[model samples]
Target: MGFDTFGDFPTTALEADQARRDAFVADAGGESIGVDQLHRVLAAKGIAGNVDLVAGDICETVPAWAAANPDVGIVLLHVDVDLYEPSLVVLEHLWPRLVPGGVLVLDDYGRWEGETRAFHEHFGDDPPPVERLPFVDATPVHVFKR
Candidate 1:
């Protein structure tokens, strides 16, 4: 849910976004999509998911969200390390919540210098082995086990 704007949370902008999406849907002339329909479509494609797009800084948002979601298992964490410093803090907050054998996928791992540095620093020596997935060769995504 990396919705628009640079560095700022999109709390103010999301209303407009919702309106835009609604307008787009209206123009498309299709039945409205609800959570169940979304889940059905995702499941048909072999995916099961839920989304909670929190609007706040990583330090403040992640820990609270984790506490609220204690029973959640097998997290497929998607990290957006646009700013490595803050992303590192977010990773720290998320690591413990991740169950054993869960996967953490870091987007832009090999491409962004700040992301690479931040990952190394946060994981340190004896960090979990990172597997670079085959995507765009220039900007490979990396996966690590929890």
Candidate 2:
């Protein structure tokens, strides 16, 4: 499952930077501008049925989804929310539901201060060791749930 607003950029930080959005659209070859584009891509890749793309604010959608599906255990969570409050909300609601040994990937970790701070604040003094993958523009970091 994935959560996104799926229209204009959601945060002020992202909205103020049109270049970043433009670059992403360009990088996607103009194929990822909206939810329909994502659906088409997933359909073409033959995995549309396997993925659930939820459209809404993460802070609202995540908790609502979790409440509706109480038994689900997330094995892998890829958080690319890019802002502090939403990132923290996602962690607070979902982290406990992540199964033991599950992996959490924080996209935009090193590149965005908000996300980086959210990661640190969410985990506090006992933050799990995260491994930064080389060769990724997003500078994503991942850690396994213990």
Candidate 3:
């Protein structure tokens, strides 16, 4: 699942790997897909491909998403603390809703300065131990669980 406020996407100008760069630019002239459209695409692709997209303020949209998905046992929270305030606010509310064993992967927590600061300030020294997730050609990402 993916969530965003602007919902910008690559315009459709299908090409090969290197040639496709232009297809995914600020104004690639590609078409955009909405949540309903994504549902249709995924439904045709496979019945088990259950994905959802929400476009709104993180604070408002995340809670609504949680309510809509009461059966979601584990949420691999991929946080991108674009800034500090709102991200922490969402985490504050979202943390209590997570199941005991569910994981919360901080995507940008250790990489970005502001994000790391927000997380540290919120949890102090009580944040989960950092572990490196498997990586292929790139550097391994640091994952902090709930």
Candidate 4:
């Protein structure tokens, strides 16, 4: 499960940072080039076998979308929505739907503005076990376990 935004809808710095982070994660294994590149990354990573990659918003029919494929091993839940209400709603709706030990990567989570602070407020002190990664051109993106 993943969400990608050009950050056009929410014209905030935080939102733009979130979009960059999303691109970073997707490009990490070189999955940004499309399905063929993603397959290559999977092969190079030695991640053979059945895998389901959900690359879209949590607000979209992700539950149903993921359900369409039952053999998914790892569900990488990447969320880049920077709005308070939308981010919270996405987490609330999608968190419960994730399988055990799934990964949730929230992008641009350290922004000082209230819009970006929503990630912390919604997750609080013990949101999940997260690892923060600093980026050169954008805010840090936090990786969490579900």
The models' CA-based lDDT, in order, is 0.61, 0.74, 0.59, 0.59
Predicted candidate 4 versus true structure: per-residue lDDT over 1-146, tens digit per residue: 33432222433336655565556556764233454557677788887345545454444544555467556555576775555555666666566666788988776466534335666777777778888877746667778887
lDDT of 2 by residue, 1-146 (tens): 97887765454344423455456556764332577889899999999899888887787998999899999998998887667667888988888888888888887776666677778888889987577676666554565454
Candidate 1 positional error at 100, Å: 1.6
> Which model scores highest in TM-score?
2
In angstroms, the error of model 2 at 78 is: 0.4
For every model shown, the clashing-pair count is 0, 0, 2, 1
Local error of candidate 3 at residue 34 (angstroms): 4.3
Candidate 3 stretches with Cα past 4 Å from truth are 6-37, 47-49, 63-73, 134-137
Give per-residue CA lDDT, model 1, range 25-55, as digits (tens).
4786433344455557767877545433454
Best by lDDT: 2
TM-score of 3: 0.60
CA RMSD, predictions in order: 8.9, 3.7, 8.0, 7.0
Give candidate 4 misplaced runs (Cα > 4 Å).
1-74, 112-116, 135-138
Per-model TM-score, in order, reads 0.60, 0.80, 0.60, 0.49
Model 3, clash count?
Answer: 2
* Shift in Å, residue 31, candidate 4: 23
Error of 2 at 86 (Å): 1.4
TM-score leaderboard ranking: 2, 3, 1, 4
How many backbone clashes are present in model 2?
0
Question: Sorted on lDDT, highest at the top, how do the candidates line up?
Answer: 2, 1, 3, 4
